[model samples]
Target: MAHEDASFTDISIQAASSHQVWDPFVRLFHWAIAGLFVANAFFTSPKHDLHHWIGYTIAALVGARILWGLIGTRHARFSDFLPSVSGALNQLRDMATGRRHAHIGHSPLGALMIYNLLVTLLVIAGSGWLMTTDAYWGVKWPKDLHEIAVNWAELSVAAHIVAVIVESLRLRVNLARAMITGKKDIRRDSR
Candidate 1:
């Protein structure tokens, strides 16, 4: 009974130390984009007005997010997570050596993935818009470009999920929960 109580107390202390990393706008943007993407990708008909509206919403959200990235909270800024060759190489070396560094924001490689997705989505939006324009109507290349971009974005999303799970296990961090609750349970020792 005493051991159980001690363990419970320890957990409480640990939880208390967890830091709020994701702000509300960032969290909302993450889940909203995910839901919108899934709806357009799986559930919605391409010819439906609803589908086009959803795509428009996604484009707007991404645009707003880009603006936020410039002037948002610490973890939400482009400056915080911009990818760098040297930084990515160092992160890769850490992975190879089994060294876990708990990042409060996106890591170097993760930053690259984020940028990739953002640009991909923007391309998807642009190509989609072009399809609606009279000049580009029935054009093969824009449609082809849009489809290719969608496929790439889907692949990137899958890879992102896998990487998140792998990193969470490796770092012993609840990253998904952080995105949900806007907090991360990073231990002092881990940092």
Candidate 2:
């Protein structure tokens, strides 16, 4: 915050003032996608109607989220979170030493993970949707594509967990709980 970096300074100030970051719709979409993904993974059978329904649910959630990012609350917007590689490295340097970089939205690493999860979810839903169509029925490649995308989604989920843990430890805040409540506990800058 003491430095002259425009992005860092602006985001730091926003973080200092951010009362609530994630909006209700964004939060709803996120948890909805998560729940349906879990249900799809466990309860799915090859030809079962539930699998198709779950896939459609995930797709719809992703579509809504994509729209939300354009007009959502401050931190929920993609413009607020996505960062360049150089900016991320600078943030990483501060993180390495346990410096308090009050990021308003997703951290550099988390921004990447957010993008990753969304992209993966989109691919998963797209391929799964394709598999349900008459042209793709009993097709080897579309099913295979769906599987790969799902695997990537699993990886992204794991990455999300690790990122939450890292940010929690670094910021000394319970981030998972924050995601649910859409609030972060941080001291108001007294400076």
Candidate 3:
């Protein structure tokens, strides 16, 4: 009974130290892009007004996110999460040794994933836009490129989901909840 009480107390303490990491705009951007991506990729009919508009919106969101990364809150800034080879290597070492270095912002590998997805989104959007242009309309290569980019983006999103789940479990943090709530309940020991 005493041990359980102590455990609960520790958890409460850990929860109490939680802080807001992802700002409101950051969260909105994250989810909006996610939902919009799904709609355009699967639900929306191709070449229709709705699909075209959604694609444009996604491109706009990506542009907005890039701007935000330049001027947004601490965690949302690219400087906070931009991938570093040394940092990634260190993170890899930590993983191998089972060291829990819970990052307040994006982890090194997470940063790389973000970069990957952003570039992929741009490629997808660019190719899609080209498909509608007068010069490129009915062109086979642009369409092929667009399809390839979509497949790559989908696979990347899947990997992102898997990584989030795995890291959340490994680090004993609710990463998904953190994205939703904008707060990270970082364990004290990880600090």
What TM-score goes with each of the models?
0.88, 0.85, 0.88
Give lDDT: candidate 2, residue 14. Answer: 22
Q: In angstroms, give how far residue 162 of model 2 lies from its true place.
A: 1.7
Question: Mind giving the per-residue lDDT tens digits that candidate 1 earns over 1-191?
Answer: 11121111112112225777889999999999999999999998877888889889999999999999999988788877766776677667767877766566777778889899999999998898899889999999999999999999999999999989997887778789999999888754443
RMSD of each: 8.4, 3.2, 7.5
User: What's the TM for model 3?
Assistant: 0.88
Q: Write the per-residue lDDT of candidate 3 for residues 48-141, one digit (tens) a residue.
A: 8899899899999999999999999888988777667766776677679777666777877888888899999988889999999999999999
lDDT of 2 at 69: 80
Full-model lDDT for every candidate: 0.81, 0.73, 0.81
Candidate 1 global TM-score: 0.88
Off by over 4 Å in 2: 1-18, 187-191
Q: Name the weakest run of 10 consecutive residues (lDDT summed) in model 1.
A: 1-10
* Candidate with the larger lDDT of 1 and 2: 1
Q: Tens-digit lDDT track for model 2 on 1-191?
A: 54333443233422334347667887788788888988898778857988888888888888888888888777777777765576677777878876766665566767777788888888888887888889998889988988898888888898788878887776655677778899766544343
Q: Candidate 1's error at 174, in angstroms? A: 0.8
